[model samples]
Target chain A: MSAVEEMIKERLKNDIDPREFDKPEFQRDPFPLYKRLRDHHPVYHDRFHNRWVITRYWDVDAVFQNSEAYTRGIYEEEGPYKFGSRHVFGPNILEYGRGDRHRWLRNVIAGQFVGQKLNDFLPVIDMIARELIDKFRKDGEVELVTQFSHQFPIRVISNMLGLPREDENMFVGWYQALIAGLGFGGVHLARGIAARNEMWEYLEPLINQRSKNPGEDLLSRIIAAELDGVKMDMDEIKGFVALLLAAGGDTTDKAIANMMYHMMYTRPDQFDRVKATPDLWENVFTEMMRYDPVVHTQGRRTVNEMALYDEVIPKGALVLIYLGAGNRDERVFKDPDTFDAFRDDLHMGRENRSGRYKDGKPGHLGFGMGQHFCMGYAMARQEAVLACAYFANSLKNIRPKFKEHAGIFSPNIDSGGFRSPAELWLEFDPE
Target chain B: MKLRVDYKKCEKAGECYYNHTVLFERTDNGFPKILVEDLTTDALRHEAREAIEVCPTGAISIEE
Candidate 1:
């Protein structure tokens, strides 16, 4: 190649160093790199990472929706290995892929989180928001993560589970440790298991109590939940509850914190619109999910050799569907990188697992569509929106505590892209 | 083959209608509406099976 040809070739190169994913700059702002992936290498085979990356919106959706080609279950069912033996949260519904048990568990457990059943739990959400806000309202300024966002969701969950109000702090501690313990092996895993065991022991009596005399709480519902004469046993019940505390608690808390971080920093002008109209908090949540969601990537493995854009991916290949990248695909979304809540292209309404919306607009893949879609989709959205609106309405003139912020980050490359600001400090007068 | 959508278990994910529009279409609401309940051809049966398999909720099934 000539000199001019070489320079042009350099510009045309779509190569993405796997190390870039680990760099601090990528975590701080990955959209530029995401755009590069979308524009050039739609299906990137990262040899270093031992995974295939799909960045386009529709491709991610296709993988998520197609159980015929891909599976969320990483472990082989027929293997000598026990399922969920090494899972951070233990044996739970998530480890299963397209099976009768998964369907059964999803059927019974999912209902409690949606429709009128979910509506019944609304009061607990509002009550917790009020309680948390009340504590920091006097301080005039509070760290959203520590003071409000972190505490609110877990407390709501604990309250919904009918756990003792006084033990809410313990629940919070265990969840934090549980989340911190995951994706990093050794000491983190050890601490996580310790926390899980401690919480499991604490839940033993509660599960027994609920089973004997069921109440309106979530724990009771799980214990009493049955379909086709099948019910979750002791380990399953406790495991699900613990998973909820970590998975549900982890996502919802980070969501609230992310929204606040964006509103107070990324889009203060747009934040004004939401403040004026509390209902706009829904839009903020939706946009935030697309813009910089709590969960950025979901892991799925290909079950068969499949033809992607140009290359054939072999069966049993690890595919990392980068929802964050797909959310910013210029093809599916207009002005993809810029966060615009009122943008007319997005669904901006209640999302479904199929990734298809009635509005003819595509939905964000943050929750990961299809069978294994975020089971807590409605609950997470409800909790995050209510808490945000609660914060917006509860705190008058709430603004960032400091003019300079470190912005949102994943803390570690292998953290699996659970992005949230380390600390979100906001100051506002008591409502 | 006759198709049945167990509405009780259905989350209205649109997998059936969205994926196979001829066999199933959207109702007045977002839930899937089976256009042709009876399938005789192998192609049609294959499509129905695909819908059943893709459904996040095990709502779709063959009647017999």
Candidate 2:
């Protein structure tokens, strides 16, 4: 009924599918679109997008926490797009049912993420980060995302899962295809189908092998753990494994890329601080997760008709949680846009504030929250700290020399997340 | 009462249905479904609670 809603409807009608707009080109800079939706078409339904996108943070968070009212059905189920088939990822949304079954899966994964499982991965993360930094120190110029950001997390996750080194590249390739498909357009539908098939096929043998001889990987451990003497089947195991890959790989990879881009562009001084104190490297990691989260948006569906900020979201209508906007909300944070590394107030306690929250207040939606917080979050934080420490300790003299590129989205504005830097060039005194 | 489930919250680990096939089973889409038409008995209630606790999405609640 509103002009903006009418306009968005018209655009959706013309666009064929809202997801097609999520191409690498558009994803490179989605803020303009977000702004438009936020200002004018805030609650407009994109039937083509197959969901209503709520850009404001409060609305998103409300839907996030109110799981009972907003069913998480769409994301968990395999509709037109799923990462793998029954043959591969097993049952599509096994961990996503209603009733007691749903809680069981959450508890298992949550147990892995909540406390000690995270601490166990710390040393492994440190080793991997050092190895990467040790390798790249000689090369002054590096694409942070591809060279470092992307590589670190996957390796750590793969190692944690006890996946064969040989299969790492294969899984990474599938993950890219799968994430790229989230935009839900013509390009992605085809890519999604193909990637899904490939992933299932690839997992067939792996799943079979793991079933016969369970290994030391998290996947194997999960399979080995039985509920009252009943073991998880082959299909369920494959799905959980693939889901783990998705959770562990893409978001953290992008987070690293975003963090580096911000340091290079907005606050070279922060990099300088980390370079100077070394310990400050942890603050930079915390700030990065708080600053420009890679997982920019999340979605949920209202199960009961609800009024959000007075706007009625009908039961079953999709709602989005905008982490990107929330982190920068002027209302919640002081100088929301400014990147301050040495702010003691934000980093209240703990030994230098590396991973987990310094204040313990949900430090932005970097890893999300509530019933479905990221399971591999601790590993993600460890990888970030490891990468930063490696860069600071090893590439001591190196400084950023990123190209000047127009921002695709908001303040962060880069490919990895915010400052969509075409390339990051670093210069260091030759060793 | 056939075993009722909320698909959004179910992670499809199938632990509930594993113990009682008469009530719970895996669906075609890879999640689990409750087939029996009754929610009676302390055992059923206990298993249901376990399922709720394990659900990743918090998408389930027992309806007695």
Kindly list the per-residue Cα lDDT of model 1 for residues A1-431, writing each as its tens digit.
Answer: 89999998897676778888788898788888888888888898888888888989988888887865898877766777676578777778878866657766765566667767779989889988988888878778888888888888888878777899999999989988788777677887888889989998998988887799998778888888876677877888888888888888888988999988888898898988898898888888999999989888888888899899898889999998889999998888898878888999998977897676556688888888866878789899999999998889877888988999988887543332489988888888754
DockQ per candidate: 0.21, 0.04
lDDT of each: 0.82, 0.59
DockQ, 0 to 1 scale, candidate 2: 0.04
Q: How far is A155's C-alpha from truth in model 1 (Å)?
A: 0.9
Candidate 2: which stretches are off by over 4 Å? A1-56, A75-98, A182-202, A343-362, A406-422, B1-64
Tens-place lDDT per residue, model 2, A1-431, is 99999999886653334664456655555555555555555565666766777765455555554557866565444446442342223353433634445554545555565346667878887887777766766766565666676677778777877777877777767766655554444666567557767876777786677768987667667667675677667666666766676656766666666566666777876676667676665677667655656667666778788775546778777777666666565445577557776654353222111122324343555555444555555556666666766765676476666457343242232121333344456666555
* Candidate 1 residue-wise lDDT at A359: 62
Worst 10 residues of 2 chain A by lDDT: A349-358
Candidate number achieving the greatest lDDT relative to the actual structure: 1
Writing each residue's lDDT as its tens digit, candidate 1 over B1-64 gives 7988998788678756645767887664557888999988887897788677767678999987
